[model samples]
Target: MPRLMILFTILLTVGAYLLSKALYLRYRHPLLNIVLLGAALVIATLLALNIPYQAYLPGRRIMTSLLGPATVGLAVPLYRQRSLVRRHAPAIVAGVGLGSLASMLVAGLIALMAGLPREVVLSVLPKSVTIPFAVEIARIHGGSPGLASAFVVATGTLGSVFGATLLTWAGIRHPVARGLALGTGAHGQGTAMAFMEGEREGSMAGLAMTLAGITTATLAPLMVRLLLRS
Candidate 1:
C-alpha cells in the first residue's frame, strides 16, 4: 500500500510539473513559475482528494534524491562559459561573497528584531542558499531543517518571480550582475529563470549559485555565533 501510494504521488507531482512548465512556456509569465504552480497543483489535489500529506513524504524523498545530480548538471553551463568566468574572476568572487554575506546578515537581523526564536532565526539565515546547503547549515546550528527548507523554497519562489524586475528598477543591467543577483538571492529557481533570459546569464547564475553556496556555508557558523551573542 505504501509503495502504491508513493508511486501515485510521484506520478501526480511529475505530471503537475510538466503541465505547469508547459503553461509557463506558453504564457511567459513569472507568476506561472513551475515550482510555485506545480506545488499549488499538488497541494490542491491532495486536499481535494482528502489524502494525508504523510502519503506524499516517500515520493518527496525519492524526488529530492535527484537534486544532487541536477546540481552536478549545472557544471555543463559553467564549462561552456569558463572563459568568461576566468576573465571576470575577481569581480565574480567579490560579488558572490558580498551578496552571500548580505543575505545572511539581513535575514538574521530581521528575524532577531522580530523576536523570532533562535532556531527560526538560524533557519532564516541560510534561506537564500540552495536546499541541500541550507538544510545542512540549519542542522549544524540546531535549527529545524524542515523550516530551513521551507524558507529556501519561499525565497527562491519570490526571487524567481520578481528578481529581474527588482534588478531593472535598481538599474542593474549587466548580464553578470543580474545573474549573480538572481542566483545569490534565489538559488535553483532563480537559475532556471536566468536560463530563460540567455545562455551567458544562465551560466553566470549557475556559477554564482555554486559560489554562493560555498560562501554561505563558510560564513554561517560565524554569523550564528554572532547572532546568538547579540
Candidate 2:
C-alpha cells in the first residue's frame, strides 16, 4: 500500500504539472501558473486523503531534488544572452541589488512591527531568494529552514502573480527591465515566466535571480542583526 501510494503521488504530480503547463500556454492566465497550480492540486489531494505531509515527504523530496539541476539548466539561456548581459551588467547588478534589499528590508520591518518571533523574521528576510540559499541564510541567522522554505514559496507565488502588473504600472517595459524585475522579485518562477518570452529575457532574468540570491544571502543576516540591535 505504501508503495502504491508513492507511485500514485508521483503520477499525480506529473499529470498535474503537464495539465497546468498546457493551460498556461493555451489561456495565458496568471492564475494558471504551472508550479502553483500543480502544488495546490497535490496538497489538496493529499489533505483530502488524510495523508500526513510527512508520510509523503520522502517521495516529494525525490521530485524536489530535481530543482537543483533545473536551476543549473538556466545557464543555457544565460549563455545565449552573454553579449546583452555584458552591455547591461552594471544596470542589472544595481537593479537586482536594490530590489532584493528592498524586499528583505520591507519584510523584516513588517515582521518586527507585528511582533513575530525573531526566528520567523530571519526566515522571511531571505524569502525573495532561491530556497536552498534562503535556507542556508536563515539557518546562519538562527532561523528555521522549514519556515524559510514556506516563506520563500509564498514570496515566489506572490511575485509571479503580481510582478508583471507591477512592472507595467511602473513603466518598466523593456525586456531587460521586465526580466530583472521579475527575477529580483519572484526568483525561479518569475525567471520561468521571463524565459517564456524569449531566451534573451530568460538569460537576463536568470542572472538577476542569481545576483539577488547572493546579495540577499549576505545582506539579510547583517540587516537582521543591525535591526535587532537598534
Kindly report the root-mean-square deviation of model 2 from the true structure over all alpha carbons.
3.2
lDDT of 2 at 109: 94
Error of 2 at 104 (Å): 0.8
- Least accurate stretch of 10 residues (summed lDDT) in model 2? 28-37
Candidate 1 Cα lDDT to native: 0.88
- Writing each residue's lDDT as its tens digit, candidate 1 over 1-230 gives 99998998999999999999999889977666676688889999999999999889999999989777876776686787789889889878999999999999999999999999998998899999988888888989889988898899889989988898999999999998998888899998899889988987787888898789889999998999888875
Q: Which regions of candidate 2 fall more than 4 Å away from where they truly are? A: 130-162, 171-175, 192-202, 228-230
lDDT of each: 0.88, 0.83
In candidate 1, position 123 carries an lDDT of 89
TM-score between candidate 2 and the true structure: 0.78
Tell me, by lDDT, which candidate is best.
1
Error of 1 at 183 (Å): 2.5
